[model samples]
Target chain A: MKARVIVSFKDEVLDPQGLTIKNALHSLGYKFIKDVRQGKVFDIEIDGISVEDARKYLQEIADKVLANPVIEKFHWEIIEK
Target chain B: MKARVIVSFKDEVLDPQGLTIKNALHSLGYKFIKDVRQGKVFDIEIDGISVEDARKYLQEIADKVLANPVIEKFHWEIIEK
Candidate 1:
């Protein structure tokens, strides 16, 4: 099974990286660009686990390590590969 | 219009960050995790453009700025609000 985790900064956490990207886009003549929020995507392949267990375990990992709970949030889904 | 860009390392590019996460997951007891590939997701909010143009312009930004074409590839999609 393949599991995907998406992690992003909390809304109140200012994202300098996103701001920099937005500025870069503006300079590149993509004047239509308004705002940008950047996030992380982790694509994982695993074995010896049921789909349910895969989701459960990945969720734990997401919380404990994949994301920083104080300033970031994460979501995960199982992908059929 | 809103657009999203997903940027990822090329197949030949080594992803040290992904490996770090994999190891972290292993240490966290997510022993089931096998292979991991990490990527970037940019969620953008924009105005004054049709969806088609939004996609086109974001694609250009992705190519020239959002991604390092020498070692990364990207895909973008327009999302309805």
Candidate 2:
């Protein structure tokens, strides 16, 4: 199975990096752009794991390392190939 | 219309940040994780614009600011709300 993890800043958190990108876009004449939010994607290959097992493992990963729960949120999905 | 822009490193580009995240996951016991890739998502609201027009505008944004064409790629879609 393959898994994909997407991690993103919580709604209330300030995203300076995202802001910087937004500003850069504005300067480059993309005046219609209203906001920019930055996030991460992790594509992992987990062979022989059930979807439930993969989800459980990814949740632990997110809780322990992939995200700062205080300011970030993450979700994962298992993909069968 | 709303738009979503997804930006990512080109396939040949090395993603150190993604590697760092993968290492962190390994440390946290997600031993099954094989690889990780990092990317960015931008959601923008563009009022009253046709999808074709929005796509054209976003292409310009990607070319001029959202990505380094030599190392990154980006695509966008307009959303009606």
| Top-TM-score structure, candidate number | 1
Candidate number achieving the greatest lDDT relative to the actual structure? 1
Runs with alpha carbons beyond 4 Å of true place in candidate 1: none
Writing each residue's lDDT as its tens digit, candidate 2 over B1-81 gives 667677888889998988887787778777777777777767666665667788788888767777788998887776555
Chain B TM-score (each prediction, in order): 0.89, 0.88
- Candidate 1 per-residue lDDT, tens place, A1-81, comes to 887888999989999999998998888777777889999988888999887777778878889887899999998988774
Q: Please report, as a residue range, the 10-residue window in candidate 1 chain B with the lowest summed lDDT.
A: B50-59
lDDT of 2 by residue, A1-81 (tens): 777676889989988888888788778776766777777766666766677787778788767677788898887777555
Docking class of 2: medium
Cα TM-score per model: 0.93, 0.81
Q: Candidate 1, residue B77: CA error in Å?
A: 1.6
Give the chain B TM-score achieved by candidate 2: 0.88
- Candidate 2 Cα outliers beyond 4 Å, as residue runs: none
lDDT of each: 0.85, 0.76
